[model samples]
Target chain A: MSVKIEVGAGGIPHNRILIYGLVGSLVLIYLTYLNTYFQTEYFAFFGGLAAVAALIWGTDTIKHLCSYGLGTGVPSAGMIALGSGVIAALFGATTGIFAPIVTIVIAAIIGAVAGIMANHVVRMDIPVMIVSLIELAIVGAMTVLGLAAMACGTFEFLGMITGTVSFLGFTVQTYETSVIGGSIIAVIFMLGAIAIQHSFNACLGPGEQQDRTLMLAAECGFLSMIPVAIISFAFIGTYAALVALVISIVGWFYTYRKYIVLSKRDAYAWLDAKPILEPKGGA
Target chain B: MEEIVFGIGITALAGALATVAGAAEDTESDIGSQGDPNSQVQLAPQMGYIHRIFNKAVAGEPPAYGLWVALGAGLAWAFMAMQINPILAIVLGSALAVFVQGVYATTAYLGRTASLAKFGQPVYIDILKSMTTVTMAHAFVAIFTTVAMCHLIISALGHPFPLPLLGLVWGIALGAAGSATGNPFYGKERQYQEQKFGAGVPISASGNIVRYAEAGQRNSLDNGFFSAKLGGPASGICFGLIVFFELWRTVVFEELNIWGPIVVGVVVILIFAIIDRYIEVWARKNFGPYTAPEEASS
Candidate 1:
């Protein structure tokens, strides 16, 4: 019956950002991010914000990640994984080579671990994002303190201060390399994680596609990073990499469209089966 | 902590009552009692109770499992594998929450007229259908809340709610409350069906499995044909109420972190469990077959 089907509000438009505004905000965040004191204080704050966002959203989302019937939350697990992994890798690298590696690894581990909790928080969209914003405020407070410590340098508070120093220890060149290199590795590990997912179906089935997807993604990253690792290649300019990144993202977008859209279960089912015996023109 | 456990305890107790009511009923009228092929349990009455309990269970499932301090929240975590929101990517995600009904009813298409309509293939296939269930940010928050809550609970270990422990404890407590006591909606659909139709076990009629499709239109009621037909909405409603109450209290008064009130979740759940039991006893004994289905409606 028509009564069974219901339309929920879902078509919130993605406002096309003005190029000027988009670039301006990026400038602001980057400037803020790179400031020694700001970096010290705000990285954790931003990290906190990301944490909160992930937590609230994770509640309902985990349900989908786990089983069916219980509604899944929004933002989706794949998005969560990318955002968290990137954010953690971004922040943890601030301290040291070890810090970035450790942090990214930890974040990835947490991302996977949090996958278990995705089903918990259920409202899905705004609530989860709001939580992340609140966490940002909390982390901001922590960042403020860290900056003051960085300025003083004498104020040692356990390994955190030293860790912060180690974070700053990387030369700008190494910073770029590690951030770029380390992120690539983090991506690799994330791909491996499907084998460890909690979803019942994922567990029950062969999971071969997921495995293949992971491999393809890893190869993509590996290829992309080859240019970055070359000492001479370092001079290629950020604008170039950014262009490549955009192209890659667009390419993947189309690929996803074809893979996910054109090849839907329903569509394939439609094409695969023998056509029903048609009734004669006025039977 | 207490609230979540109490909530689940109550829902399970509700589930138990649904089961007990059936077990207590006279077998002749109920299908289980008839034990014959021609006999079918009267659909309407049992559906009513099942509807009521299931609604409570769905909304309440989260809070009940609060004690476990499980679940991680956030955006990044969701996309750790596939970057896009799998739901939008898949489109099938829209089916979440309503999926049980969909799956439950989908099986009915397999009814006796055409047994091998290739139903078995789809049965397993349906589970893979994705829902826009979670996202990167959601996973982040969940992880943060869950870990933070665990840290808070384990760190203090002794006292109730501490600021550090708020997300973990209260989140769990509230989640469990919603899951267990808020309504029978969490996973109590089966229990609801069992309690109502359970009295007359179908000869071969699948219990709630087939009921998903058969669940409508015996009597016209205010809500709609399925209002009497569909009952799980109550679970959503109860969940709404619990969410309303919790958010109202916290958002308005800022008790989001204060722990003493957390014990209420636990205590209240326990109380609810005891009451649900009492309600069942009263319904079966005093109400004179109030909870049972018509033929089974002793």
Candidate 2:
């Protein structure tokens, strides 16, 4: 009961592994499909490996410290899956280089809640399940966007569509007038998000302050990505990575501010938000 | 080369094993919750509260930093290998320069070279004492990685095996091995604030973030970054050069199979071991010297 909870924030073994494997596989497969469809051959080994390492770090840090409970695994898995989704989407973006800003921002938000949840949110099923399902949808959306990008060598709603390197690498015969692809992706994501959210709550259970914090952070993570996806368009040249990074930072700060406020507002406010290693009294 | 690998493997395995053993050694009854390590206390109110923000920021910094260090050490090893020198000189100098000094090297490089490098100071662990050493290490890794990456690209393109490129690859890989072996503890949010911000942030730090989170309590100010810091990057960088050039010999002069990376790997490991041993001696000599005098007086 007195064991320490850790928080570089990546745990929930079963679901997280599933989510990671799914996202990784999906991206790989989608890229493969696009490559085959367009007759190109490029490999993003570094990208894939980097994502895995990042995901592993998150899971190892967040989950290993988790104590036992009825369905605590939900949030654990949910948070990680959500994180994986964010990372995968960022990776899937044609402007993947700028993805970290979103990832970082979301990561902090998730991390805070994960930290708080590490204390409370014992029977976490609904949110965890919902986040897990969202990961798949996120990956799917990203894949669609990736496929579109692969098709036209441009991002969603961007004015100009270009061609893949044709004979050199993964070929997507994208020329101008491929606006439809990205929109379709948007539609799919919107439709899918609801189902995913439903499952998240299904996996999650009763109201604990810790649960609130974790859920809030996870929500912040998703919200963080919206800007990431939006700002990625303007990501250019040297400012590319930094811009993304800044966005992510903002997301994290936003999550923190929201949580701090939320925690303060709660009647059961434990101003001393230390982890309740004793499992039951956490949140 | 074989020796270096053996060294790192032995060190990492031993270190890992020792860590596990030490944890196992701690019984439920033997210690406290870090209050005294012998007495159980409630979630001590003394813990830091401004905890999550700093924690998140610091936690966020590492992957980028770690990746960069790993890659930088590799790249430096490769670049230094370009110059042939005393086996000792090359090995020791580069290892120190790359693995230990790599954070410094990257800080210097980024500060000088890239636009973002200018931001190097604030975010990067100061080789001297700043929050961004981890960041600096990672940046170096990235630079080295790009160099190695060029070779990989060329190799995939199937021109002649650019002999120089392998150096970059081996250098970065070995550097990671070196850095990982030297300072292996992963940090938490509380640690990040205490270590990184020094007195800059208003966040309070917890003795242990294991449980009971707090913020802005303002206990002691501990910006100390060197937990068990030593200079082994030099050894790592050198080993990378050695193994790389050694492999280059086979690549250019004769035909070898996968022995290139393997041999390089071995040398890298051995170099780390030797470096670790030397560092232990150095630390003992410097830090322990005072202890001996104090003990004598007692």
Candidate 3:
């Protein structure tokens, strides 16, 4: 019976923010399905926004789970979440209209089993580990699904593996896209894992606050979107990928500036280092 | 029906291979002191505890393996497309991947240690020369087996996703399993053996890893010996079960409809959740609280 450690809070409860993240991400990602109707990949940038939301939710779960003295489990938790997520996301993509909902169910199941094994077998004894794991897994799935949608313009497994190219609004060529073949999915996996995990790893301590951490999470998400948006050029086309890149840069800038402000506010004193006067003694 | 049976066979084979890969991955990570616990190794030097632990964390195991396996599988896939022999391509691909792993390990070890030079930590070239090969060797086995498993899933089982994608997914899963399941055994049981067993790491002792061995000062190599006994195999079983159950659910239930596996998966998760709850209660009853009654109440 280890005592659970509590993370500090800002104005809002983490759970409420978590709901915002979950619902916001799911809704935005589901919007990408509109591409099926529009016959264009213009809505793909919404997937990047969805990833940002999922990453925010994931960051909170990690903070909550690691608050229980998980020592070094922070990054591991992130990887595990994304890892299990890839499995669930792939499986879910096989389903037609039910991809998003099915992804949640499968990811939850995988996360639950992994969480159980961690508690009962590994015996970390963290009270919130199971629920946190389940949430992280879903977040991870959404991150993967979101990024894949951003890159491939669709989360369908077949859609990911195949693509068509048009020149100046004229049909030109149909070819196999490299989302899966060239291992762009691998890029998405690492990007999402790092973006989701790096937030807490970078900003954890006794003085850590939720608003600051969540701000960083949002920033990390947008930073991650840069690469995905670039990759989206091959899959989603020039104009759609350009829109994603523009949105990613704008979102990233806003969050980054907000994060810096939050950091300065929480900090006791902020100082810039003076330039080194030439070393007094030679090496 | 035959396809289902064949999927079962492939899943079994993949599971067995995942078991081996999982063990090797954890062992290699333990040898390198790479992951959450690596932070402790980094902090030890700053705390004036200069030790010879091989601190080579290029990234966490999951993403690292994801990169390696994906690279290997991608190259192999390209070679296969070029009409090369599959077995030869796999070997070549894995060898190249292992080389990349070796480079990352060497550079990370050197770079981190050099940064700790301000703390009077010595750069032990011998440890670097010796441990890099050991980690890379284990990494080769893990990477090879994982890429092979991905290949089997793609070619034999006819998984729609290409080899690189499967490699990425399973590689991450393999790393996750090892990190979650095996690392605590190394981090808590082996590294911090001075502490009582089953008592979780206290907040006060976050970066203070055990630096001494039974004989002399401890190193990551010694940690590997202890973790290989329990941690390695536990991770193996964890990963094997995950792969097996995941594929097993699909193979057995997907025929009913797309929802079949999802329904069954939900049921499986619910069952585990109940068991986990029971275990939590039992453990609490048996072990009692770490805090005093008054402290716990407060």
Candidate 4:
């Protein structure tokens, strides 16, 4: 189907945005880990924010790679990214060896190999395949780790494993927390997948622009935070839950407003002009 | 201007991070003053706002209704609260959500495109036809590989990788492999049609060359089963060998390093790749060229 929208002229290069997104996500994730380790009750709110940043980064990566037209649908690309990401994240978390670094490195390596296979072996013929896949993998790993950390309030090896087990409803034979916290990772993983994939899938067209797509990304990111906030309410304290709610609201409002402005600016001539043709006599 | 917007976003994020960090530090000092965790306030009202905003944003859009999203979230939470197996809850809940949304989006897209076709816009029916067939085949391969990976991880290694993680790993690996393999296999079968825009024309026009095209004649069920049949055993054996080697070295030889397993894994993958190459060649030679009944009669 033909897309009606027009691509915008020059704007910030996607690579630059991607770089900033990656740096920002990594910093936020590290800070979240620190905060969760140092301060327990307030980890949820900060960690949730970190997850939002990761979502933004991941969505931007999707927008970048998908613009090249992956022969395997956009959703498929997203699933691959998340799939590699979750595995790497679990391995790192479970193995107790520099979890974040390991996760990022492994995901990147796997993604790169997969990209090469797609290009040479499968012969998909997408030029930016390798770099894009690597970026997608790294960002996807960050997204999963960030969200999982937020859910469990820490990314430490023992805490993450125990959190995961608890979330799975398995008893440690010695319980610590009253509520199951690890199950929230499943929620975050699914929501993060949707947020990253939906922005580009929904906004794609001739008129697809970075600004509008980013706005949609922001919206999706905020929407995904709702479940995180609810989970925080049950596990974390009231203050953390309230903070999540507030951040989501403020973020949504800011992004939605920007979307309206960009949409208006990008509006077609027919959007404002009156219809010229009247209904036929048959009507 | 784009740089400026990105800069602003970064700044805003930094500011928020600082605020949260400060608050966390303060909360740490005042932990004794905090209220009971069980007496925490409900999140329904805030969640309701999120639902409303999401609904408004996705209004009239197929597959992403607020109700379904809310229901999915609720089911996940409820399942967890009830102490249901976390993996089962997530899989079922996510599956339900995705299915509901997929149906809605597909229906809407098809309905709108069909209407547009009446107005003279080309509706590529073959695109949809191929998608269904391809997705079914890929799903089978992916599921089989996942099961194989899970068995290898759990039964052999004594490490119980969670179902969710296993699902993601095998799902991605098999999905990518299928896309890589299926594209070339099918690309060889059909001739590419020129189109003005949007990827390529997905039409199935007659081509003069028909060598090895019979592969396309197989039904999706047959194709799916064939892929699973080849892929399942290959994955199982590869993983089994890797795990067995690792176990042998770690348990019997008292070697704790992972290099043995890594090397074994690589060797297994190489072996599988070679076997796959042979299978492809055999299939191409045996399937023969496609000949339409009409073409043969003419």
Candidate 5:
């Protein structure tokens, strides 16, 4: 006999929740655009919020896809998401002001093809594989863009790749920057990949619940932002970088507390112990 | 024209190296009994079937390989910046990465087994002593090939991205290919050989894996022998084609315009999508679904 179990069986419909995440993240990611008009790095932390929103959506997508007997696909999906997304993001970040939107389009195309390959060639046979992959791919792109913005305070290709000074039409000198030259994008790649994937993997089980998983996802998103924010000190002023750090820590703390409470509610028993093992009746 | 030829040559070399890396990756994972199927190994102890399996899943293959290849490429990049010979730098970097992989394998196995001690799962020292070096040997091969491929892309192809970033991307792809194309053989065929072929694992059989060997007791080393025959080669082909096609499009069409490669990529994807649909339909028609218990009895 075979049985099927829904991840968030009785809660709000996942589609509705997905909409909330999609709209919320898209809006938050645009906050980086404010930097253009204001010409400041104060709004950089909004990129971190965008990352958190995308991870929430990614967690739900992973849950939906893995429900179809894809016990191994969870991590594979995340990795493929970032792998394709990285390529798309590199192309998109080159475009000014429209980087986020362009990234979504390219990532969608890449992810759709991958999903088709998995379903038909790899024969995964999950019904939602195509759509879920599209969503994860978009989420992966947003996470990378968000963290890269947080790290460099801008996603401009020139800003990320080098530190150069220009006078009207003449180039003065060029120096190495941390984002690509120092290989910090590599850090962002792993950070976003692990943060998006680990939340669901850690919370998955028969008794898994939606609220706890989402909260942990949010916490992980913020936790990942901390490193990027710290790295931003190399690109932006200390004061601006500190603002991003404070926001990340605060967000992380709030979500972490909520996750712990939800875990307690769902767990059959809770034991906060030192060693967590003791002599039993027989022993 | 000369540039095109050089690019094509580099693409073929990258594909070949990717093939080697992909094959070695699956072999290493099979030897360690990692991935989704490792769940069965974890369950065996609780189900009163303790055997000698190396449970070395510190992380998923993609992320784990990304770290290993990135670390190696990063070290190689550093060494190259210091005017060291590129080939020697890659070799030294891969050696250091192998050390890291070895340490992680040792710790993961020891930590997991110790936690399962309450289940009467004794630590098999002989298996641990023998298998760690074996896994490291395969890890070195995988890491070396992957880093060399990254170097080829950067130096020969003049890719804009640095070595570490390229390493991270290709490493993840190699692991993804192995996970998608190769793992089924290890998880389904080898792990559950007693089950009827093509009948997917039933819900009732979760965690009840085969524990006894043909001689005494099964181990991860035994699983490797079976997976190497099919899984490794399949993964190699899968990753090789991915790298080959990706580079081929860029090399052949980039001169026309930036959108040239994009168009070619779309066409390639459409081609694969069509082929995949054919394969899926063929398999379904030929194999059919698993026979139900009630149907079998009737």
Candidate 6:
């Protein structure tokens, strides 16, 4: 049932995309900090775009893992990915010291442990399960952290800590920041989850093709930006929201059109008229 | 603070009294209508008290029962609003609602799984594995919508609404919407029976029984599509009302009380429920008995 393409068995080689996505997002994160300290919201907006790029990578990983037909199903992989991702992102963002380093190190450890548990303890039995889980976790975390940087206008540790409530009442003064900044986690979590999962789930069927599936992934990634854009309006301003919304619209249309073309190419038949139906038991 | 406490206590007491009265009336009607000898036994108090409470909260009729649960949830949130950070309050409140909904859905799923096991069918492990993810997705969407609405309120009013109270309102609205829209993917038995369950069970041995077992299954895609359609609008309205009231409170009525938004929410839910019922009927009449053209042709 798998379609083989010249590039690889799938339309795009997973490794190539994964490499591009990983390198691309890390660069964007660094740029986001530079812009926050130097330039304007426009540059930070570019950093937000990095999340979409990471989503494509995440979706590819999902497609790869899910293609094996895991007993737990596709969405479970998405959940596991996001679960580890959110924890990592939150941990990284909130750490007052060496935030980026801490986030990656912790996320990798958690992802590795989760992968081991899913494979050995739960006996999911898929050979690639371990690596897939680890990669998904890293990508998921990166996506969350990246988008959050865009939303909050920086990847710096201080601003991110603005709204956090300390359990020991040490940070009660930060309550205002908590109200404004805390909700960003929730937004990113949902958007990341949808972008990672929806692509494969929507496109899976007999005639499934890799390019089309990836296209759908792109569409979902853009769709996820709608909420981010709305939240941007609240946090940044109308200009930021407009920028995000415009990019999302353009991306969505481009991917959607490509998907339609691939879908048409893959179609075997089309029903132009409704068939007259006789009554069931014998009309 | 004392007045707030007193008001909450009074509202909760009133709601509780009304629920007890309603239950009594419902019990009488249930007995009269069922006329089964075991109807009284069915009414006998169950031992699993916590389970019973969850089942009542999560598994009742669509919007009506869901609204009732939301109302109770709102009251609970009101109590917590004064104590916790707004974000924390929302997280906790929504988490509680989602957990209840998850347990309720899982219970129904277990019953279905048990029935499949009885027939010596190979129940796919995928169903079990994906259950948590599905429930979480539904809950996550609810939380996102709620948070967005809260942000809108804060932005428009230039002040935050009572966090816990808003959370409760969103929780109930979204929770009820989640329950009402329901899972189209797994609810029907027939789809799996034909594709998965029928694989092992011999037709001769099962005879006409296999058809009976398969009767409950519906097309997963159709169910999913319908669910999204119904749920999207219901929750959208809930999100909208939050924005509307927040603006109203800011611009026109600085003193606009909590009751105003809650009351508006109830009316919107009622309208949606009525529309939902018609959609249900329409879907059953028109879109019922769907078979994939490819599958049919094959």
Best by TM-score: 5
Order of models, best TM-score first:
5, 3, 6, 4, 2, 1
Q: Per-residue lDDT for A1-283 in model 4, tens only?
A: 3122223346677777777777777676677665545675565555556656666667667766666654225556666777677777777766443777788889899899989998999997778888878877876777777766665566555654442224465544322222223234554565666566766655554545666666666666665665565555545456766776687668766765675565444433112112211123311
Model 4 spans with C-alpha error above 4 angstroms: A1-9, A95-97, A163-183, A269-283, B1-75, B78-298
lDDT of each: 0.27, 0.31, 0.77, 0.46, 0.76, 0.48
> Which residue runs of candidate 5 sit more than 4 Å off their true CA positions?
A1-180, A184-283, B293-298
Least well predicted 10-residue stretch by lDDT in candidate 4 chain B: B32-41
True contacts kept of each: 0.00, 0.00, 0.08, 0.01, 0.08, 0.00
Worst 10 residues of 4 chain A by lDDT: A269-278
The iRMS of the candidates, in order, is 15.2, 19.0, 11.4, 14.3, 9.7, 15.9
Q: What tens digits encode model 1's per-residue C-alpha lDDT throughout B184-271?
A: 2211332235445334344333323223324631111111222212232342344334443443333323344665456555665677
* DockQ computed for model 6 against the true two-chain complex using alpha carbons: 0.01
lDDT of 4 at A45: 53
Global Cα RMSD, each model: 18.8, 16.8, 12.2, 18.7, 10.1, 16.6
Q: Per the 3 Å backbone cut-off, how many clashing residue pairs does candidate 4 have?
A: 3
The TM-score obtained by model 2 is 0.34
lDDT of 6 by residue, A166-239 (tens): 44656354634432334445545555764576556444434456776676666656655544554444345457
Q: Which sections of candidate 3 miss by over 4 Å?
A: A1-174, A177-283, B202-206, B291-298
| lDDT (Cα, tens digit) per residue for candidate 2, span A15-92 | 555456445534443442332345432321212222322333222222322322322232334334444443445343
Best by lDDT: 3
Task: TM-score each candidate.
Answer: 0.33, 0.34, 0.56, 0.50, 0.58, 0.53
Give the poorly placed runs of model 6, Cα more than 4 Å off. Answer: A1-8, A94-102, A163-174, A177-181, A270-283, B1-186, B189-298
In candidate 6, chain A reaches a TM of: 0.82
Clashes of each: 132, 75, 0, 3, 0, 6
Identify the CAPRI category of the predicted complex in candidate 4.
incorrect
lDDT against true structure, model 1: 0.27
Report the error of model 3 at residue A204, Å. 16
DockQ of every candidate structure:
0.03, 0.05, 0.06, 0.05, 0.07, 0.01
